[model samples]
Target: MKELNIAVVGATGAVGQEILKVIEERKVPFKSLRMLASSRSAGKEITFMEKTYTVEETTLDAFKGVDVALFAGGPASRAFGRDVQAAGTVVIDNSSTFRLEEDVPLIIPEVNGEAAKNHKGLIASPNCSTTLLVGAINPLHQKAGVKRIIVSTYQAVSGAGAAGLTELEDQSRQILDHKPIHLDVFQHQIAFNLIPHIDVWQEEDYSKEETKVLHETHKILDAPDMAITVTAVRVPVMRSHAESVYVEFENPLSPDEAREILAAAPRVVLQDKPHDNIYPMPITATGSDDIYVGRIRKDLYNDHALNLWACFDQIRKGAATNTVQILELLLEKDWI
Candidate 1:
């Protein structure tokens, strides 16, 4: 494969930083690198591959001569996506802004790699929680035919971006100092409390994050009619995100069979041993690239339903690594 010149938009943000880390850790073959951010962050230096590169203001022209552009920023993609594509750069966006569009492919390479082949210069990464959950569930669903999914998320502050993590840390420090706690990024204090809300509330009372889980899961799995209900909650943890998933399949599957299936799934690690106290935990999963799943058992109330727990580094596998993996696939297929 030929070395490509890559541009990383929103390089100053948490996910963007993780993208750089993954690129370095995996030794992605990039002939050149450019960092782009907002004017406020311009001129800030970010170190990658042992050298410092200053961030420049992101503009349409910034994509010039770039072979691939990774947009980890927010809705700013709307303002610059066309320009990036017009400049002949294939964009892999990590924002929700474009995932649902019919023209753009919402992708998880392991689940639907062929979707990447149809990209019209842009591809989207699914929600962090949705990505991890589907990474584990898709394999099993393919094997046993999933009929329904009931998931409750225990998401980390990092999913809310850097400000979310800072709010949690600062609130904790204030509580430790016996000072008044200030809540900003979230409706309630996230230092020691769990907010049963993520993103905005919709008319049906489900949060945007919950809706993303429902919608993105179907889009990626191509199972639009699949029954899914989600409750997304923000926890005090700084990194990994966890999920309690209850799934009902078309066919009955044993705990051993479930483990055997999940164990062989791509980017999925089965850690289900209750007697040894071995299971997926946020602490153990943080900084790792695979989704860890455990607590496999048949649901007592429903014969075909199974309950499981899953965890993954929200920044890595959920955001950065998934994006990088998509890029790797693009390279392998000569899409870029």
Candidate 2:
């Protein structure tokens, strides 16, 4: 791969920082790096790969001569995604702004990566929870034709960005010391409690996060009519998101057969050992690139359906790492 000039929009944010780490660890071929954030974060210094680079305010002009720009989930993508692309830079956006657009391909390299080649200078990554869901199920879907999906996500606080993590830590400490807890990042006290709400309410009483899972999965999997329902919940865990998935297939798939398929699936780690009490957990999944799946079993009521648990670092594999992987795909295919 040729070294290309790269730019990162929203560089001061959590996902932005994770993108930097992934870029370094994965050794992305880049000739130059430009850290672009909002005016509030402009002029700040960010050191990556042992070199300090001053952050620049994101602007249309900053994209000149840049080969690829990675947008770290925000209004920045909506504000500058197309203009930057028109300037000849390929954009891999992490926001929902362009995800459902017919022109933009929502990509998970291990899943529907080839769709990225049809990109018209822009591509989108799915929501963190949606990414984990499809990563675990797509392989099985290909083999047995998934007909329905019911998922409940136990998402970590980190999914809410840096504020969520800070709020959880602060509230936990305050509670431990018998002091009143502060509530800001979340709608309710989230230290040791679960909030079954994530994102704004949508049509038919679905939260925005839940709706994203439904719609994005349909698009990415090319199964718009596929039955899917989601219950997205916010948990107190610091990182990673876990999903209890119930999948109904057109053809019957046993737990053992499902494990056999997932065991060989790319970027998916099968940790199914109920007797040993080994399964996917947030603590073990944090900072990891692969999605961990376990607890494979037959659904009690549905003979054609199977149940399983999936977990992955919401910040890494779910957001940052996946964004970079799309870029890597573009580079490997000489599409950029």
Candidate 3:
């Protein structure tokens, strides 16, 4: 529990801001903190631990003397990851650029914490939807064995970053005012409608976001042969993302038993009760650290298939919290 020097790349973004807040909420022992962002965001001040720190433009030299670098930035990691690692800093990257790399481990401390122990100075956090889904699925897989997974996400606008959220708000205002709607952040208007696509469509007709869920789940669960299919849809919600997950297990499990198992799992909250209108919802899940799972029931057609609803704050547990948790684990193991 020794104090370590910490640096936050993309300190001005939604996820970066959450990382700073979580660091303070968790009272992480840090000897020093440096805020690093793009040149456009340089000179902006961010308050953490009761003091304001000005963000500096990120550069190769940013990692010097830094012990842990939390990267909520995007592909810019391709520009700075190696240099930071070479300088003896552990980079917890929140980007898709490295998650699939064979050498870079995609970690969710509660799931593949042991994999993080072997980090060669870089760890990747999975996609928001993928992270929460696996966080809920791993415990069950260990107990009953997950045979196949089919998921459709009702993702929040914030998953695309702050711009996406703003677009939703602005578009909502426009629609209410009978003004022309601006549909820039998404391929279609997202205010009163759902977009079936989350990211760019690939040759296989799956969006990039859908593909990430498929691959990331396999990697984190260490189940490369697990049957998984995903369809990501962008919803109008501003914060938390929800998923309708249908999982087929090798062994049949009662809903009560699955709830019991998930209740004990780390970072998962079970809120199942259909008749009473009790279930996980995005509005209720926002700003929380745990992923919420509810509406658990058995699928009618498949004997082993179970239906579930999962929700979590996309910017927190989905991104920043998981990254900070990895940092905590790294510190616990003396990896940073």
Per-residue lDDT value at 95 in model 1? 87
Report the error of model 2 at residue 135, Å.
0.3
Over 1-336, each residue of candidate 2 has an lDDT whose tens digit, in order, gives 889999999899999999999999999989999999999999999999999999999999888889899999988999999898887899999999999999999999999999998799999999999999999999999999999999999999988888889999999999999999988989999998999999899999999999999999999999999999899999989989999999999999999999999999999999999799899999899989999999999999988999999999999999999999999999999887
Which candidate tops lDDT? Answer: 2
lDDT of each: 0.91, 0.94, 0.90
lDDT of 2: 0.94
What lDDT tens digits, residue by residue, belong to model 3 across residues 36-105? 9999999999887789899999998877889889999676688898778877888899988889898889
- Model 1 TM-score is 0.98
CA error at residue 313 for candidate 2, angstroms: 0.3
Better of 1 and 2 by TM-score: 2
Error of 3 at 254 (Å): 1.2
Tens digit per residue, CA lDDT, model 1, 205-234:
999999998899899988999999998999
Off by more than 4 A, model 1: none
Highest TM-score, which number? 2
